[model samples]
Target: MCDTTPKTPIWKAIADALRSDLAEGRYTPGDKLPTEAALAERFGVNRHTVRHGISALVEEGLVRTRRGAGAFVAAIPTDYPIGQRVRFHENLIAAGRRPEKQILDVEERAATDGEAKALVINTGDPVCAYHGLSLADGQPIAVFESVFPLSRLAGMASALQDTSSVTEALRALGVNDYTRATTRLTAVRARATHALHLQVSEGDPLLRTSSVNIGEDGQAVEYGRTWFAGDRITLTLES
Candidate 1:
């Protein structure tokens, strides 16, 4: 017999199922989740309740929904050692996944006030801006815009190739020495460009991170804005 004693709240029950799956590694990072109907059937709930549960995960940066595609589990965000430096490509590869990039724009542009301040350069200073989607297994993971001072990265714009990570591009410019970074993170809705690049629904939740990289001499080397698909990535820090 079905123990249908009007059990737990449907939404909370669904959330618990997802949370348990995540903790047990049943739903690994970067994996697409079942459709709402499927989850509803699996949990004996209505689609609306499944949606409510999904929204809760989105608010926590644990999952995201695509316009036509459906839900997906967030990927694991690599954490560089507090004092160690690593490239995004290298980090993803170490996690046993192939890293790729889709270049949206690469050009030398005058820094905006915010960009200039974040990079500690004068407003209107020349900054090489690299904008693109970083992917794992051809699925959009993070949308990024990396800005570096032109004075420190001469000819970098011209040297970058499609699908090249910023670290590789910097190395090509002969500026390999870099220390770790300080990062700040929060949950946010996807902006127009960010949603388009990540292929997620408009207003879908994302993990917004701002990072400033410093050099061995303690000079700011680069500043970046990264928007990660909330369901497709998780940020982890290690001591």
Candidate 2:
């Protein structure tokens, strides 16, 4: 003789299946899930069962349903730490996200007034400008620009192109180490280009950071600004 416990409910099975997909990164933040009809077919259940299962996800804040559109995965803000020694890859790795960058532009340019002030250089002095977008698990999260005094960091552009890492590039230029000497954070609205690059609405909130990095000799090595998607990052200050 054989005995069996009551089988799991079909709706709960659907919910559990979808939850696993979300947890394993199959569907990232802001991604649309399968339509109710599609899910119902896949699960071999009725639409009612599918809707009931999805409702559990909505209640748990893992997914949101739009009246006419569809269910979408909810965004969970990634934790970012602000401190003297800040490394983008390290921070994202610690948060369990794959970090990546798309270098948009890099060139030697005349330092503007703001750049001069931040880098302690005269206006019109040559500077290496590096621009890029940062992504977390394939989601655009921030756009950044870093300016370096070209006279001090010769061939900076080539180094950045080779490494795509500020720390490694600076090291190639003979700057052994550096630390953040100043950090000024402000809340701002995304501009047209920023909005386009970050896939956010124009005028959406953005977290802006203006910072300067100093080398072991206490000389300014980098002047940088980063605009982060307001809804995608939770910045924390480390004491």
RMSD of each: 5.3, 6.2
Task: Give one digit per residue, the lDDT tens place, for model 2 in 1-239.
Answer: 67787899999999999999998999989898999999989999999999999999989979866555788787789999999999999999999999999999999989999999999999999999999999998888999999999979989999999988999999998999999999999999999899889877678789999999999999999999999988789999986
Candidate 1 residue-wise lDDT, 28-66, digit = tens? 776789999999899888899999999889788788667
Q: Which segments of model 1 are wrong by more than 4 Å?
A: 1-65, 68-84
Write down the lDDT of every candidate, Cα atoms only. Answer: 0.79, 0.93
- The reply for model 2, stretches above 4 Å from the true place, is 1-26, 33-72
Q: Which numbered prediction scores highest in TM-score against the true structure?
A: 2
TM-score against native, each model = 0.68, 0.76
Clashes of 1: 8
